[model samples]
Target: MRALRTGPLLAATVATIGVFLSLTGCSVAGDDRPVVMVSTNILGDVVGELVGDEAEVVTLMKPNADPHSFEISAQEGARLRSADLVVSNGLRLEEGLQQHLDAASAENVPSFVAGDAIEVLDYSEGDAAGNPDSHFWTDPARMIAVVDALEPVLAGLDGADSTVISERTADYRAQLETLDDEMSTAFAAIPDERRALVTNHHVFGYLADRFDFAVVGAVIPGGTTLAAPSASDLSDLVDAVDSSGVRTIFAESSSPDRLVQALASEADISVDVVQLYTESLSDADGGAPDYLTMMRVNAERIATGLST
Candidate 1:
């Protein structure tokens, strides 16, 4: 069973590292908007609010792309090289793109690590790699840090538009406050005993802490999906679910849900697999189109799902 888990993740890691690195360059020829590239779709959404058609914010990773395993193209390198500013979640979330970010910095491209605004969960990716958990946006209060960090960076970009950036950021920050308030109210509806979460990976430590749910366990058994679970790990998780009385194992839409479904069969327990946005945001029409709506949708699902 250990081999069942480890084999695929290892293969995924190798396959990922094998891809041609995304391109980098210094020219945005034939481009009209001020070039800005955001590492994740989640950050891209927030950036869009501050800039609001004033700039073309490049979202490098698409919706549902696993931050750990996303591939990049040479066009992306050109975008990075030409970007006036680069916004990233940082904390090693971009496994393949980290060095590219460093390159941009060395070239004196203005960049900001969005995660710097929040308290981060640090973890070793495995024995060989050291990486932080890098999922701080799960907690909206901590996410204020992302907005705070964006202000100075945006201001630095627009001396003429400092007032504009400040006003936009201030407005967006208030909206975030509202979103956090909504999440708190929604989470407050659930009972204490039923408010336990078992997810694909350790993505929600901050969310669990903020909204009063206990992170009973994770499917990966480690900090990341990059790490595979042993048979023992699966067995331990099964035991945790059974003992904790959590009727659900939340899965992300990005990855295969078969493993969790299979684990449920083996454990002889009935469980509902609830889907949630963990790593990416939906397109404009989906339940979690942007960060605020994503959290709102998740809070509703979590609160209602657990309280049942």
Candidate 2:
């Protein structure tokens, strides 16, 4: 497991080496509506939908980037501090960017943390057990909670149109409700015995909890992708995979599947590897371009992978 950085060290790192945003840009101080800087693409999509044209939503993470380790450019870091509002997944999901977020808070930029809006799931087992799982978007109900939490936050933003925000929030919430039902229906088709998951990392705890699947184990031992599995870790997971009898091991679009593939080779039984949009949204050309589409596409892929 990776050594957990102390909060002070993280803050010092942020002060010294901030999340590097690659894009060049001056701060948007002249916009009529508040400029909201969101840390990840997933939150960017959902918040963009709710706020619509009410605010300029500048998302820091690029499409399909790993949220756990992606950094912002110094210019982007400046924008993060200067923005009217900053939004982050929180609960330390933004592993590399926590310092910059802390700096933003220190600078007094009003911010919203999506993690605070819903029930948090901790790793049920492994070295990182009892640590909050930051991938709560897997469960649409939690996202609904995020939407509920974000509405008032958006309403409070400078120059926010409360009525438009309210109307759009309602529309998006309905869409999420529809998505939750769809995911539940899709997962219901998989047998109870087949509902076990092995993945790149411990990213699907909320999804497993939401839909009644068991997280057999992860390729990495912890909640963050930065942690690599040891030989013993891989050996233990291979044993679990063999006993669990799951046909497929899921990999995230953002993370490398090489570890998962290596694990498959070591398993006593043959197990296929399937890719899912576990952590980040993909580009527009990819399958999961937005939050709703992401969940729907992931559900279909998971159901097919488990049922077959």
Candidate 3:
């Protein structure tokens, strides 16, 4: 089986940093306001929008980092344990940080999982078939559900202003609704035959479900980027690509696109690779810095990629 590998040197470096932070007793900067430690940058952005100035939101994952494999510094782990409220994209999405999340839970930190707030979809194919998908943020309606569930929790935080949270919640929810409408409009123009998705992994199942697009297949054979595709897996995907006539395959910003490019090149039919902000938010200068903007950009790209 061909695997997507992380270098041992990088892993060792991260481990060394983690050990140093733990020994130094270093923690994230804090203030009198309640602290909200979030697992992923995508949820971090949304929580920041909802909480505004009510709480100090600290996101562990950096911009353009992979949630499935990104490790937190021990100092950040300390902050996570001490936070008044913890928010995470659950459904086993934070594969590398599950231990820290569990430790925080054991410490009795109040937590809200966005996955719990939505109608979950299971992986429909590959080794992860029937596993709950953690990529629900692809659908704006599901995100609105998360907001609906999270508002009361944030309002109830000891240091947060319930009135302010309620106001922000309503405003953010309206924005999500608008995003849903705009995405619908954009995707409606795509011809029915062209409304199909082939991504680096099964990151777009929720999107396919929400927008009536068929998921042709993935370059990787599972839901998580950590999984590898065997020779047969890649051959099968190439065959599916040839049969489906899907010209555009999406590469996630959080993952390297070499494998996706390879798949495109190996396909019997000519295919183009398009990058999408699937699992993480990018830096300020990057195109997909926020959740709403990311979704809008992806919608436009998908529509354009498929329409042509």
Candidate 4:
């Protein structure tokens, strides 16, 4: 068994990683087909595109696992320890697995936080660095930041196979750009009056900002699923859904929709809790098997929900 010890540079890096992980998840892997452990399924999809068969990827959080509520199992701890590298989305989105990341760092393995690559949106009254809006992928443009981070890291890792990594990353990035255009066109079709979105929570702020939609409110009310909505919060959201003229409330495929439903009923608003793949992609057999497919599906759902 490999022992866990950290040198000064690695120590500092890990400490910095912890801060970002507090805001979201982090990931890392090795040069010769890194054993990449990502915090969420969505991230796994993106990494899959870059690493392809070169890396053995494991996503701890399942399709429906709540990022905040997900707990790493004892077996998963072993996996983290054994991984050659780890890659996670930085920013406190994966509240559940930060501890495991810490453990991996203690093992002197380098871990990465993808969110640190992008300029974060600070939604709080203060804290200019950003108040942890972990759902940046909702905006395809912001995801370009993720892909940018992804390409270089992947290139460095697969030195011998660097050509393939660079080419594939470029191709994937181009596709992301095309998807961004498609989303823009699809969203443009939504009437301005109906462009306001009411979702399960504030996951779509970046997406709304990207496509010119106003994010009214969320059913759960925050970035992580750690906090459930209070009765007042639900009532207020239902009222906001009514006042904002958003006839539908978007539900993340990963989170619960019952509360959103009850709130809509209480408000007597014709709110439809439409499911969209957000944090996690659909299962392998499902339509959204990768990051591109996942984002496209969400855009389609959002466009259709808002239009109809």
Lowest lDDT block of 10, candidate 4: 121-130
Q: What lDDT does candidate 1 reach at residue 180?
A: 91
List model 3 lDDT by residue over 161-216, tens digit each.
99999999999999999999999999999999999899989999888898999999
Q: What tens-digit string does per-residue lDDT give for candidate 4 at 22-44?
A: 65643332234567788888788
Roughly what TM-score does model 2 have, to 2 decimal places?
A: 0.89
lDDT of each: 0.79, 0.90, 0.92, 0.76
Error of 1 at 221 (Å): 1.7
**True-structure RMSD, every candidate:** 15.1, 13.7, 12.7, 13.1
Off by over 4 Å in 1: 1-33, 123-131, 158-160
Return the TM-score for candidate 3, rounded to 2 decimals. Answer: 0.90
Weakest 10 consecutive residues of candidate 1 by summed lDDT: 20-29
What TM-score would every model get versus the actual structure? Answer: 0.84, 0.89, 0.90, 0.83
lDDT computed for candidate 3: 0.92
Residue 62, model 3, lDDT: 96
Clashes of each: 4, 6, 0, 17
Scored against the true structure, residue 248 in model 2 reaches a CA lDDT of: 96
Question: Residues 116-220, candidate 2, lDDT per residue (tens digit)?
Answer: 889887778778888888889989999999999999999888798999999999999999999999999999999999999889999888888899989999999
